[model samples]
Target: MSRSTSHSFSRSRLAALAVACAAVSGTLATLPAHPAAAADVAIHDIQGATRISPLTGQQVTGVTGVVTGVRTYGSSRGFWFQDTRPDADPATSEGVFVFTSSTPTVKAGDAVTVSATVSEYVPGGASSGNQSLTELTKPTVTVNSSGNPVPVTTVSAASVPSAYAPQGDPAANGSVNKLPLRPRAYALDYYESLEGQNVRVGSSRVVTASDAYGELWVTVKPHENRTKRGGTRYASYEDQNGGRLQIQSLGALDDFPAADVGDVLTGATEGPLDFNQYGGYTLVARELGDLRQSGVERETTRAQKSGELAVATYNVENLDPSDATFDAHAAAIVDHLRSPDIVSLEEIQDNNGAKNDGTVAADATMRKLIDAIVAAGGPRYDWRSIDPENNKDGGEPGGNIRQVFLFNPDRVSFTDRPGGDATTPVGVTSAHGKAALTASPGRVAPGDAAWANSRKPLAGEFTFRGKSVFVIANHFASKGGDQGLTSQYQPPARSSETQRHAQATVVNAFAKDVLKAQPDADVITLGDINDFEFSGTTQRLEAGGGLWSAIKSLPKHERYTYDYQGNSQVLDQILISPSVRAKKAFAYDSVHINSEFHDQISDHDPQVLRFRP
Candidate 1:
């Protein structure tokens, strides 16, 4: 799946409140400053030693701190203030956000007293599994003084813990919300302990590009899981790449720099550390660093040799005939990917593209791309795909996004067996010890519940270098319902994996069927898997030793096709059977192009695998 938008707390809080419902709204209501609301404890005491605040749901009075930052716009506007005098406990945060539900009059450096209800505001929602943000909501704030200097905390490699998260409590059913904050050991604990505080970071490398919402990602621990191209590699779930932090500006979007991966943010960037729905811990910058272009160029994979059959996977990010990026996408395929002999395309939409008028044919979409490819100096390509039943395939509604195969006729041939349709199930068969598909361009287990409302695996038989190669193109179920990495659950719930694991088993069974039919069958499966190589999904795909994720063949640092939230992780991959994997000379490349740049036509870096079957 692709990612998104503005890191605004107000909008996020609005959604969070709506999701948490009116009961939470009532609990965190504002009241006039009175003796009843006068607990008057230090900010750190309220922040407590755990992910959840100790003073949640309590009315507190005379809470004093210096305003470090203020959000005066949007429905959930508030000001972040830090206590002037701090206790010596590292487990408690000295700063806190005061939610007013409207514009705040206080400015940075103003000393203020707040009488409000302390709350553990969960971003997204309580069910979203995200860590709760400790906040003083619906406050009656009184400006006590002006021009007080806001204390700034510097964050660097040495300041952040190498460990990412703490173990969840078994009593709480894997919830870490009540666990004591291990600020010195866990990165999440460290960030949580400093939430709402004024923080500063020096010049740093931009890992994820500035998205459409004028936000980017930076890392303080530069060397943690460092990729060769200046990014972090999220190799596994256990190693969450703790140093990565999202960057957002409190100022106007027009002033925010458009930065790409490998760019450097020169000088100092300072802001109040806050938690939002889109990304967990973020620095909403009052002062932004200057963006310095690092001259990072799109990488080109070496052309496939005459003996090698080059197969690739590229997710065009919901491409339709009307899409404007056709030319740019064509150029990437020709110039950057060296025009792989066979490319598996994901998220190819219908002609009308989200019109939702029951249209399902995608001939126009494929034709536009093929024509653009030819114009970009690539060979004329032939594509095969099955149009899904309207609204059945999950994606942009009415777009009817489906997996497609594009093969170069000059270099390879597509086997077009008859009778393959939207609902037809593909079966593996053997003809004279050669593996073949019952319906060449057919759906794999189309009726299976595992593929409900998702793109069914598109199976096709092909001939390359006079050798039969069976390829199963898949755009598996996305990570739509999964909990975020910064969830309250210590090992945050990957709820989406259940469906993917089932999908993998379906694909795995199909591959095993073909292997059983033809023992020496050369089978390859590749597409936007929407999961990591190390996940249960991949494990299911590789279950019976029938298929192996070819991306794993590369060095650990170089095995990613997408850069998400500053972690270079694998979402797209190519898997091959023992017939292909046994030939260890096969080369694989996660061609660096779209995902690293803001000028991307697709959010995925295409994966290319070259092997002599």
Candidate 2:
């Protein structure tokens, strides 16, 4: 979630506009005088057929409309007006944003006419390739009357485009961000055409739960590929699912409805189309529809069957002793995820936890977590890990987050060996007709450039039911610099995946070496891979069929372990080797204790897999 740091409109003009446009009664009094040569201009004519305003850089006179909404605060000090009379073409919207640079004097239901210069304002300046918003700047307002009904246009399911964006210039390899608008065909184009228009979205389903910022994302098309939880899935690259729209209530924050994923919005929600930095095109709702809960609840704890070795992976989101969320996290692991025999824990911060004074030991942090788990009715689990060099790992500065292992002593035992450290690489060796690690809990290819400034994979040797199994815990590079879905560049750039791909290559190679040494080696590579199951990083890891994602055993909609913008995407995965995949006794479940709820202990949900070795 992002906050608006800068004003959407000019701040300099705000004070003057506020003083000139004081609150007035319903009666039309002290109307501003108009010029003798004022020519009537329709809102649609000014909007034009394309995204760029046709009458830009020119002064237009005698623009008339009924005020549909008013924004009194923020940099976008303006009132939205819709034309009482609309155009025949559905592509052109009959509304416009009049920038007053201060508190809007006009109120909803007021009939008004204005003479102003048509200007196109590009947020973040000209260097930003973002779409420009059309506005009437430096305006003189005249109140014709009050209590006039505002015109509203309904956006039906058929109006929503199926395609997300237009095919940019092929010569530029889609790098050319700007392209001509196709309002009829593309989703972005269709929304841009209705920018600043008073529109109604009817009977929409909530795809994203409301965030801390009081924002919700909904889909108007009910026929889209939807999850059982009521969220529309990003099923394929071809289906963009243009029905999605962001809902923003700029009114009193308390008035904004609290909604969750799978909720339904009944009746029509009336709002003016707004384009901003956080989300491309949002509906600034003046009247919200009724919210209906769809009875979606968090999943229960997974069951572990007899003669099965249960393993799980969870990203604890920088857990530390100082953080107050440890107890809840422990309860989630014990009560909700069913306490797997061996669990890969990621983002375990240093002992001090965010105190930048160069403390790297996490014994205190780990002990506190283990104690809490025991108090929560879980087994006494022993742990193994190697501390990273001070501040070398990339994460919250001073946090020094790394991966650690927790194994139930009653069910499993660590096969401890020598020569494991932060910089040394772990290798595979044949022992007793089985594949084993040189060091029981050793780092994998730590000196490789691919592991620089990132958490190194921790490989551990464990024995369960007289059988040896190896588990590699990894925390890959985060998606920090990836372009947002609403980015000006079509098919937004995923630059962060480059490092993750390199990391995946090294891990995959290590897994293959173990398989080569012992054909039936039970190697389980699991942790917060920080990429989607269908992503290129996952494909690279499973390229040679060395590892198989256990999450694939479930249905497509049930594969998510993280939620972003209301889309449940996979970030944490438990991938098993062919020896585990070939067996038909494997069972996998994504225990959903956190991601969907508001008071989440971590951003990611835990994944548990049970298999017989």
Candidate 3:
């Protein structure tokens, strides 16, 4: 049968057609039909048929399917569901959804009929130019489940699947493999500990979720099918398996009490939360304590003058194309980057060794910054990054945009020597959206010909005050806009949410491996995470993994390192162990703009931290 007809097949039933139709079929053809032309509808007349376009904002009704999901609005409700027509494509047709004052009885898997008003989606649509949905509605449904209707809590840590098995022996397989770029050892260990534990979590932010390995995080959430496969069975079967969250846990949201989405939280009494390039919001556990009526306990503040250990991050405002003024820019950049023992730099250019100047360029801007660092004075700085030369891109090609760290060699030393292979660096996508490598400068990975052309992340181990600190530098895909998704009928362009999570997962894997090598290892992850503390990326990276955000331990003034178009956020950050933060091991800030006279050399300001170790 043609692929279009194959939509009826379930996951287990598609084994034969999977290989036969691989080359014949493109995307399946069961997408939603053009919306209905009318503005209003009679609720009694459309009980069994699929509901398309309705009067733009008029109340309409139909008994189609159960309210499989209900998104509550303080007083009203919203959700989607399957149509009652057996021959109709429930996967493609607008399932029943509702926006009303009543909190309808709906969970992810349970299905019944819903009575909702018909309406067209709101304004913005399309990704990479493909048609997208803004809004759809269903009225209500009859609850068939036992007792009272059990609400499907937005998949959180508190819910555990029945088949869950604790991940023992770090080598054991997890729900998914995280990307192998800069690994997050502590984060991975903590996630492994909760392999089978039941926990409560929230849909903190909408982001691409990935597994422990550097791959996509796939799980089933009722009617929602994330695997991109056709038919509802896949989601139905996997829903039994449960949805997957990242290894990094950013603590509970109750700690910060962010009233709305996209809020940046800092210094909750609960300790630290992890942030990432993907999305998700998070706060520390200590902060959660403060939310209680009893108030926070054991709170302490330190003097800033006592030689604090520092770390900072910045988005170098298109820090590419090496020009003479670039050095002045680099110095100015560093001046703003300031005194953290480590600094994360984003948007650094990469050359695939095929340069017009007859030089094998890594990221020219990164190279120039390192040269400037040496010129300013050596030994105060030393850096390690990954630059694999991809032979596919011509020899005179350019490298990718990437994230790198500039560490004080006098304070930190390398631990993992680059093993001749392409070490999974930190990034998941290049500045322009290519899956390439972007390293600062240092030893090249063995057999990594593509590193020269890509903007992937580069990672390494270091020592400070005789203590080990593993630094994982990353720059996630940007969500600047959806212009990249402007296509007529093409599959949707990769969402920044998903790609960023992929990169975050890659770092999570690196962390897990590190802990496997050293169970009691002391690690610190600091960089330009490209996300806010309360976002999904941060939550998964912190809650799933064990990485901690230093912002939770610091005062608010130092919470954010970059301000764009009035959006003050903590994109650059430093996440350390609870033990380290307790000892006051570091301090950081959104420097340069805050402390210097520089006219914002880059989009991100510098940060500083000081510590004995």
Q: How many backbone clashes does candidate 2 have?
A: 1
- The order by descending TM-score is 1, 2, 3
User: Residue 499's C-alpha lDDT in candidate 1?
Assistant: 89
TM-score of 2: 0.88
- The model with the greater TM-score, 1 or 2, is 1
Q: In model 2, which regions exceed 4 Å deviation?
A: 1-41, 54-62, 99-101, 114-130, 136-140, 171-178
Q: What is the C-alpha lDDT of each candidate?
A: 0.85, 0.78, 0.37
My TM-score estimates for the predictions, one after another, are: 0.94, 0.88, 0.42
Error of 3 at 96 (Å): 36
Off by over 4 Å in 1: 2-39
Better of 1 and 3 by TM-score: 1
Alpha-carbon RMSD, candidate 3? 18.7
Against the true structure, candidate 2 has what lDDT?
0.78
Best by TM-score: 1
